[model samples]
Target: MIRLAGLAVAPWLLWPLLGAFIGLMPAPAGADDTASSPATLLPAPVAPVPPLLDRQQVDAAIGRLDGIVDAAMAKTAIPGVAVAVVYKDEILYAKGFGLREVGQPEPVDMDTVFLLASVSKPITSTILARLVGDKLFDWDDPVRGHDPSFALSDPYVTENATFADLLSHRSGLNTGAGDLLEDLGFDRETILSRLDQQPLDPFRSTYHYSNYGYTAGAVAAAKAAGEPFEDIAERVLFEPLGMSRSSYRHTDYLGHANRARIHVRVGDPAERRWEARYDRMPDAQAPAGGASGSISDLARYLRLQLRDGSFEGEPIVDAGALATTHLPHIAGRLPADPTERAGFYGLGWNVGYDDLGRVTLGHSGAFVLGTSTAILLLPGEELGIAAITNGEPIGVPEAIGSTFMDIAQHGEQTVDWLSFIGGFFAHEFAVDPAGPDYAEPPASAEPPRADDAYAGTYDNSYYGPLVVETEGGALSMKLGPADAPKRFPLTPYDGDVFTFEPIGENAAPLSAAQFRTGDDGGIASVTLEFYDRTGLGTFTRN
Candidate 1:
């Protein structure tokens, strides 16, 4: 994997398959995510295709969603997009937007590759279903017993927790910087040792979303299915559905020129400073979220799911398995996680329902670098809609499905359920949190000097070797060699406290920093706090 900060390229290439996809590395068709590499960051824009009459009407229902996504894309400076839409068994929409690269001037087509991120989970689940169909393994089988290499710090948990427990996020694990570990190509044996670091109470009442849980599940699936997870996904889903372009291969496998340029927006507008493109992640984390493919492939995959895992008039996964996969294993209000609170879990999917209890099975995926998807199925309505966008959609799946279902089932408007849940949280946290937390939080007690004090090297457990620097009288954080945190002015609160309004708000949702003292009453490290369930960590100067 290549690492270039600020999304800019060095003299090195971005690898081969990506370059092939970008087609050209020239301006307007530049490859890479942030903007740097052997290729230019400012690729030429392809011809714009205005939304047509049909598109306009479709946008009307999904407009709030469309607005949220387009704003995020513009804010991020990502150049192109391709999406597939499926309603029940019908392919309602298959379209591409913008271009794969800026300079190549070729619009993104049906086969442009992208990093799938957590979307890989459903594919993993599909593979396990096939194994269940064969009686090769049961979902309730304790995962550790299947793969003896799977051990936790707590042997009891490892010895007892079943695949269903881990698959559904009941394993109570954390990210554990799992992607970074896997990116370095850590073997299964080495990585399993970290399992003890994340503990779970047998009947923990609260829900915790764990990506690491899925990684372990992926590993277990490979062992129990008697094949690699990639082979099972292709054989059971991709090949059967004719999703030819889909691959578990990393986006980095593509040559530099063939990859779509990724953009990081300075502000929430395209007119602002747009950073160049780069993809700095390791290829080994593909199981968590690294597959790439075109819209057609996604549509075909959706078609297979809509037909109850049947393709070409034959059942690839038995109907019984499919039902259990969609069954609600656990039910509660959306978990109390601070940042990623879209909905709750049903096996590998998110289960969202209303008071009268109509169920929609779905899921969403996103990563800081790029790529995302939102898909929901209404069994009673016999309708399924899958919407995959490149970045944050702020709950666009409900908007898309609501609009489509209105027109599909004879023009009836239904409440946007996503809006309700999202808004409920907005009112709770963004609008009326328990109390006025940061409405004029204390100003920094220090004078407005250059980024002198904070501009130095620091370290953390999650991401190491963090370097902060001063530029234009504001402070910016360099996270490893990847993207630098946006610079912002820092101010003083009361006493010796300080406030970093712009950048600090984004840092972690804490108000300000306060110093604590040792037994001698001397200065010690300051703590950065956040809301419930989110982590609160401290950094001491070295």
Candidate 2:
């Protein structure tokens, strides 16, 4: 009975949100790792991404939010959103918006579950902190102390990497370095084995956001606790905190009936049209971003943070240990226009100051299957906000959080954030309606060779084998390790270039597949440009 309304609008945020903060940029055509003829490429103008928020509009949005959300949802056509606000040790608001599914009449309610994505990190950190309170392992203890097999390319880092370093994303690896393996169905152990082969960024010299680093920390925590990561999280975090409705496993989330379906806009920005897909992040990545829960459940989490590691007069974790998670372990800058005046990367939380110079802590997460989430905690103000949407790249979560903060700090004012967001995004989409048009090849060009010529097995060190085959004069691909094989149906665009649409229950956006010819006119290699604008290159013919 607590359904509200919200608009899922924002053209700039349309990029895939699976990785760390570094992979948010939009992709361009002819930007793949392989060499191709310029004449065969299709280039289009890239739209300028709007800044995070407009102060005036944010103030306005908070006032007329209901009507604004209704109008914005009407325009964007997004299916559903859920929001929760915790102020001064109490939940000030908790509600859902729109339907759980497009054709289903069951409206989303406060209990509707949605994937937390990377927002699961703070919880993970909190659990680890509890384990530390039990003297399982110290934060600065070397990772190898828990798991001797833990190794990295840099010998010093491999020997000295601590639990704190991994949680804070300062383990010296590049952003999302091993994500390719995990996405392709590789297990955590398998991906971790190949991690030493990746290049290191510099020993604590830079903050390179990494999902793998957090997973590594989780593995270490599990090793020290003598149990699985999910089990430890449940015992130390969920159960202790009384979050009965939350779970770290996707399988568990699926068993719940009130979960919100994931969705994304397919064609143009002007259209609010969306396509729903089930969450496909493997259980192996759960430690990094696989938890699911409802607004009511998240409110409990915010409450726990506000109380400094206590829930219902019981100490779930030592306040001192919990405070360590908020301490700035590494300083860094955010992607905002002004470069995030004062920002630091804490364990699983982004610690920074708002425009009002008040301390704020938060993190965000998303997946290719269509989910975006953000959680913010203002310990100084005893306020927190958690926003989850079944759609992506809309900036809805941040908008909601900032709107709530605006209300908390400056007192309530006349604002319609949703309508203002919708109108601004609608106009921006109208100005540059085409999305990723620059990433496609020319459609009129003929195939460089027969379909049979390109049919064969291609392989890479990290991504494994990709089998391209022709069936009934059409091309299709099956890739990844043997455990999880994904198939893609291909359509020829320009010469030797084909676009593949993910085929299966959990579908992804169309990706470009370009086959390169050798000097002898035989297919030499193929390069695939994925949704995140990163390319998997030189899948040499086998």
Candidate 3:
């Protein structure tokens, strides 16, 4: 639960940005490309978005979020979208807009189903929580003890880490050393064997996002409960929460005829929209993120969490467990002003914070062209928000998320749509011609040499193994098990500063990377902050 203040574009991050590139920023990318907007396949917007809550104040709040949503879409490259808000047991807001399938021209509505991606974690966590309550397994169970099939390159973490450790991301498993990405064609057993090569960091310190880890834990839960992951989910979550329209298994949606299409954020309006899929998980990883449902159905589930883990007079997770689950874990900090940090991870949700630092437990997901989200407040208020889209939008999930809280917690109105987005890209990500980044100093622009200084295996649980190389007078971004390492021609921008230009087609262009020199005056860990992704990480010499 990295705080939203750090990640969401705000007034402060927008000012200088607009001043820098409002007039000269690159023309929106071609559709289907993240760097640009869509080129074709534009779908018609849905009929007027239907309202869920009628409160003027609530509408004002929803409007603020909607504005951000519109802008966020422009940045993220999303197509159609559906959103729902719930308070207590009452539906507050529900709306639909954009196309459902880019190739096809259908609109989206409440019943449209999209891949849940990581948003599936909380629901999976809720089910496992019920299993824990049922004495099926203990949170303390060593993950491997419950399912010996679980293995990683790091033997110590493999044997010592428990279910709790896995949930907390302290298992130290670097990204996907097990070759899950490459083995998209393999079955469960085939992929799990690659674990021996993936190293884990020392366990129990910080939160590391790992799809493989969560999927593995989910598989273990399924094994422990003696049921298929989907079955267990149906019995424990979907049914009780009345997410009847939801399914763990994939399906082509026929309901809620008006659904948003998936679009590549190629920066244009004309582009093809299509469905995308997730090929990883469940050698047994159902527990991390593997479920989908309508926005309304997810809202019901959120209402349950908002009501202290109960909904419609039924307790999904007891209040005591709810408290424990919602409590913060992992010093989980997103980059932002320390004073404004506003969220943390609690069990499975990415909880948000406000000016008061209160908890707003929520979660969001992004897989291919689609993004899913569920955000709710559980303290003094019981506001909940959920959205599902077939195609990914530029940061729409977060935009919608923050606006929900601002309205729910503070009664703020939605900002002006076009203006906000106009301001947003202008501020947060724009590269300034005269800014400090361009003015910084680096040790030398002379091509970095391969002085053993660039040799080491850097491991990040979320990013996996990266082999740094000094090849042909340049650095290499050898993302092991992720297709191939793309080479970069490093150009120093400032002090130990550099930018990475990917080689070959579809290679990222002109992204920033910064380095730290070791005591001996050679580069140590080079921490990179790239555009359009989660936290940037280190690539140690391997």
Best by TM-score: 2
> Residue-wise lDDT of candidate 1 within 1-542, one digit each (tens)?
11222322111111101110011111111111332311111223333223222434443434343443354345334566555556446665665666665555766666666555556666667667777778776677778877887765467667776776666666656433244334333444444555564445443233455666666777787787788866777777777777776777654336534455443334543455434344534234445555655567777766666667676578887655654555444433442353222234545665443222334555555543434455555543334555554433233333344445444432334443344433432332243356336546445434433345455555444333445566565554443223343333334455435444322111233355444454665434444442112242354544
Whichever of 1 and 2 has more TM-score, that candidate is 2
Candidate 3 error regions (>4 Å) = 1-56, 59-78, 103-105, 176-184, 251-261, 267-286, 334-343, 372-378, 413-542
Candidate 3 lDDT over residue span 1-542, tens digit each = 22232444332222211211110000011111111111111232123222233456565776665665666566544667777877656777777666666556666666666656567777777777777767777666777877888877667777766665665455666543332333223344444555555555656655566656666777787889887888888888788888877766643233334333334444344654344432222223434544666777777777776676677887776554444444444434444665444234545655433323333455556543344443444343456677666654334554565556556444653443234433453354345566334334455555544435555567654445666656776655555345544345555565555677532211234666666677878776677665213233665543
User: Looking at candidate 2, what is the lDDT of residue 113?
Assistant: 88
Worst window of 10 by summed lDDT in candidate 3: 20-29
Give one digit per residue, the lDDT tens place, for model 2 in 414-522: 2455445334433432423454442456656675577788899987775778899876667888887786687777787788878876443223456678788888989
Instruction: Go through the candidates in order and give each one's C-alpha lDDT.
Output: 0.49, 0.69, 0.53
Better of 2 and 3 by lDDT: 2
What lDDT, from 0 to 1, does candidate 2 have? Answer: 0.69
